[model samples]
Target: MTQPSDYREHLMAAALFIAGRRWPVFPLRPGGKRPALHGEASCPRTGPCADGHRKWEERATTDPDRVRRAWSAGAFNIGLATGPAGLLVIDLDVPKDNTDAPDGAANFRALCERHGQPVPTTRTVRTAGGGTHLYFTAPASCRLHNTAGKLAPLVDTRAWGGYVVAAGSVIGGLPYETVGPALVHPLPGWLQFLLIPPHPVVRARAAAALRNAPAYARAALCNEEENVRNAPVGCRNATLLRAARALGRLVASGDLSRSAVETALRRAGQTAGLRDYECRSTITSALNWSIAHNSGRGAA
Candidate 1:
């Protein structure tokens, strides 16, 4: 039998399935039943841990029939993983029409308004037949853990609350739809760029490199990759788009070598007075702390 400690790791890791990369942090569900699974039938109203250790029946294939049923009924998201105490969900909510974007637009708008941040230009995306997805170009900081307590409230699906961030990966939910591009706040663009990388070196390099690329593509590259494909896009700036672009330009223009770009990025990070290095270091410490203090529960 797996010890409670082992189960704890499994639970957190599983919860992260939805919240880990670009998903919201799985907030605590109400009634002490853990977070509710999105899209799937709500957990039987009894409570959490009614069973010694809540466990989900392993499925060879999550029912595609369920997904079809969900889409027809206007489900915005689907459940990715579920167990006795908790579940992970992703957006599958489809758009109402070609122009009607996914629920992500509404969600992001709501989140930004709540936070007093300016709303960005948005578009609807259709993922699979599941539903439309709204894309937002906020900041890379948006993807990290909900540090400001802004995300938890939005995602909080207290048992009685009757609201849920739809769960499930694109694969589980029949398929995700592409509504359009997510909204991007009309900032100086530099703000959006700088907030991207938690890495100092990458941030500096990307900052310098982006100077020469097409402005629209540069911004789109930063926001589009994560919002659209959910791919990291770049290593430091959420992926390597800026760094790679800079290197490519350097190679083409013969202005600098790849090694020089790297060195400049590092130097820029240190002298640019950006906090990517500091923030990255802090997050690394927090991760280590989280690992060290395993509480045998879902989240610390």
Candidate 2:
């Protein structure tokens, strides 16, 4: 095994190599997940701009020079910014202390089977802690959020607003290794559906009663509308689609008119900063899917 001191040069070389590939990279403290910085203050106390021990996500950079400087001082782990680099990582965590935990890989396979999709073989990285990171390209229209134990026990996702330590990074004298192809593949569509599922359409009561439905139903609709209206860039289409689908359920139950749903979705998408054409296309597609799947039924 290479001593920690001996790995500095190799780490710097790897950092430069990753940056050369246009993947934003940052430094993590030696053998730790925290950002590696000289004197940067942590966030909340000093805000994210102080540069003192700042979050790796905020400091991740694609500039080769910046990456070189980050690894020049000493040994550091490389962090990959997922969303900015258009990457998504599925982290299969194996419990270090528990011996009876279910195998994450097996669980992942079963999940794919349940979804009727093949497991994606992408860029796989073996983590220091005996876990795995499966890297894939982010879908063009969907921004997956990080969630622990969402897909299966100990299965996590790292995408928008998240980061993953690069394969060459070392922790506790153990290095992350590439166990699969070097290239990151695009996310499979069926897996994408499982990850970012459309909102469920609940059964509606009488159309006249729906107009005077309980406060909860109205609140749910308002929340969906707000989600569309406040969606950030890179996520507007998905948010708009969700909102439109919610409205479509209402339309299916005859609680809302199709034209009303379309107009509302268009307005909300526009408010969320989508272009006219994008809003129109997304709303049209979402309404079509919702109406087709939800026709003649209030429950989904």
Per candidate, the number of residue pairs that clash is 43, 4
lDDT, residue 254, candidate 2: 62
RMSD of each: 21.0, 11.0
Estimate every model's Cα lDDT from 0 to 1.
Answer: 0.35, 0.75
Per-residue lDDT tens digits of candidate 1, residues 1-300? Answer: 233334333334433443433333333232122333332344443433344333332211133433333334332233322221132122224345655443543654565564456654443435444444333333333331111112321221111112233223233324333334533222224323333334567556755766665655455434432332232323343223343443344334433333334434444333333234332332334333433443243435
Q: Judged by lDDT, which candidate is best?
A: 2
Give TM per candidate: 0.20, 0.64
Stretches of candidate 2 exceeding 4 Å from the true structure: 38-55, 197-300
Report the Cα lDDT for residue 46, model 2.
53
Which pairs of residues clash in candidate 2, taking residues 3 or more apart in a chain or in different chains?
40-52, 40-53, 41-52, 203-298
Model 2 C-alpha lDDT per residue in residues 1-300, reported as the tens digit of each score: 667667888888888888888888888887787766534432443544544545567668888777777788878888888888888899988876778867778778877775567888888999998889998888999678776665677788888888888878888878898985787889887667657733324222333344674565556666777888989888888888888887777667666666655655666776887654456667878888888888877355
At residue 103, candidate 1 shows an lDDT of: 52
Give candidate 1 regions above 4 Å deviation: 1-34, 37-63, 66-118, 123-134, 137-194, 200-300
RMSD of candidate 1 to the truth, in angstroms, is 21.0
